[model samples]
Target: MKQREKKELDTSVQGIIIREMISHVTSEHMIGQKIKNGELRKKLVEPVWNVPDGFLLTEIKMEQFEMEWLEPESCTSDRVLLQLHGGGYVGAMRNAYRNFAVVYSELGHGMPVLSIDYRVAPENPYPAALEDAVCAYRWLLQKGYSGSQILVAGDSAGGGLVMALTMYLRDHHEELPAGLIAMSPWTDLTSSGESYQTNFEKDPLFGKTKDSLIYNREYVGLEDPKNPYISPLFGDFTDFPPMLIQVGSYEMLLSDSVEVAKKAKSQGVKVRLHVYEGMFHVFQMAMKLMPESRQAWKEAGRFISLFKDET
Candidate 1:
C-alpha cells in the first residue's frame, strides 16, 4: 500500500460561515422531515436556483425521467459531463444542480453537461436511479458521443451512483467513460466507515445520527447494504477509469472517500483523494462563494484537462 498523503485547505471565513449555516439548518428532525415531505425538500434547496449567466439549459424528456443539458454559451469541446445530483437517493435534480452543472461545464473547460433527475427512493427504489443513469449514458452514446468522450461526475449519493454506474457498465461489458469526479461521495450505504464515529461531532449535517440508514433505508429496502450497486465502497475498481475524489475533514463521509481511494488504488486504478481541512460535506457546491470551493473546481478542471483528448 502506498503511504497516503493529505491535501488540506485552510478554512476561510466564508467556509466557516457556510459550515455554521449548514449546521444550524440541517438538524436530524429537518432531515427526516425532508425525506418524508417532497415539497419541503424542494423548498429547502430553493436558494440555489440561480444559474449563472452565459449558460443555456435545455430540458430533454427521457422515458421515465427528465434530463437537462447545460451548455456554456462559449462551449467548444465535444466532451460531455454526465452529472448526477446528490440528494441521498431521495432528492431530485433541482436548480441547485442546474447551477452546479454550469460550474461543471465552466470548470470542466467548456465541456457541456447533461444533468439528470434520476428516480429517487420511497417512490422509486434501487435500480430505478441506476436505470435512469444508464439511460442518460446510453442517450449520450446514441447521440454519437463515444464513451471516452464523456466524464461522469456527481456529489453525495450521486457520487456513489457514479461508481455504481461505472461498475454496471464494466460488469455488463459496456464502454466506460474516460474518468470520474466525485465530491464528498456517499460510497458506503452500510455506514461502516470509522469517520461516522470519529467525525460525528464534527459533521454538521449528519453527525447527530449514528445510523446512516436514516437517510438510506427507503433506498436499500430489503437489499443488502453492502451490495456494490448500493455501496460502491465494497465494489471492485479493477479496470476503472482515473478518478478524482474530494471530501471534507469535518464531514462524516470523509472515510467514504478515503477508503474508496484506498480500494481503487489497491485495484490499480488511478485515483486522487483530496481532503479539505475544516470544510463540511459537499462544500464544492459553494464554489461561487468560497475560495476552497473554487479551488476544488479548479482541481476538477485540471483533472478533466488530462483526458480531453482521450476520445
Candidate 2:
C-alpha cells in the first residue's frame, strides 16, 4: 500500500476556519428555542449557497418529501443520487445544500441529485424524518429507478439518517441502495463519543460536549437516545452497502464517524474513512472556494459511480 501523506489544512480552508464556520457561533439555548419555535430558517441560509456555473437546479415535488433537483446538462437520467441535508434534526434544507448538491452532480459528470427536504424536529420528529426519507426512496423506486441505481448521501443528521434508513430497509427486507456517502454524519445523537469532549475546543459548529442536548431531546422525544433509529451508531451495520465517510479532523462529531466506520467494518461492510486535517464539520458546503471541499465532493461522486452497474 502506498504511504498516505499527512494532510495539512488547505490554505483556502484555513483562511475561512473562523470567518465562515467557526466565528459564527450561537448560544445553544437560543438556537434550540429557535428550532422549536420555527424561527431559524432565514438565519440558517448561508450566503455561500451559489450554484456553480454549469449546473441547473429545479424544484420538484415528491409524494412524501419535496426535493430540489440539482443537475448538470451532462448528467444522465437513469443514475440518481438522493441527498439529505443536515440541520441537527431541526434546521431545514438551506441553500448551502442546494449548492453542494450541484457540485456533487458536476463531480459525477452530471449525475442527477435529488436533495430531499425532509421534515424536522419539535413538530415532526424521529420516525417522521426517517419515514419521509423512506418515502422519498420508495417514490424513486416507484418512478422505475431500481435500488441499485440510487445512492443515498447525507451530511450530519442526514448522514445518520442515511444509515438509519438503510438499516430500516434491511430490517424490513426492502431493497437497499447502491451505496452510501456520509459527510460529517451525526451518527451519535446521544453525544457520547470521546471526540465530543476532546474536539470540542477545536470544533467551530458545536460549542461544548453537551451542547446538543436540546437538539437531541427535541428530536428523540419519548425515545431512548441510544435507540438504533435515533442513534445509528448503535445500529446493526451488517451487510450494509459500501460506505464512504468523510469527516474533518477538528469536528466534535469526529468520533461519531469513526465509531460508525469501526462498527461497519467489523460487520464486514466495505468502508472508507477520510479525515481531512484541520477542516471543520460539513466543510463540503465550501466547495465553491475551498479546494479540500471540492476534492471531498469529487470523492463522493467517485464512490457513487462505483456501484452504478452492480445490478
- Residue by residue across 14-111, what tens digits does model 2's lDDT show? 53554344434443467644533335653565665566777777777866568787787665557788889888888888877776676667656667
Q: Over 4 Å off in model 1, which ranges?
A: 1-9, 27-39, 42-52, 210-214, 309-311
Candidate 1 on 99-144: residue-level lDDT in tens?
7787778777788999999999888989899999999999999999
- The C-alpha lDDT values of all candidates are 0.85, 0.78
TM-score of 1: 0.89
The segments of candidate 2 whose C-alpha lies over 4 angstroms from its true place after superposition are 1-21, 24-58, 62-64, 73-77, 212-215, 309-311
Name every residue pair that clashes in candidate 2: 75-110
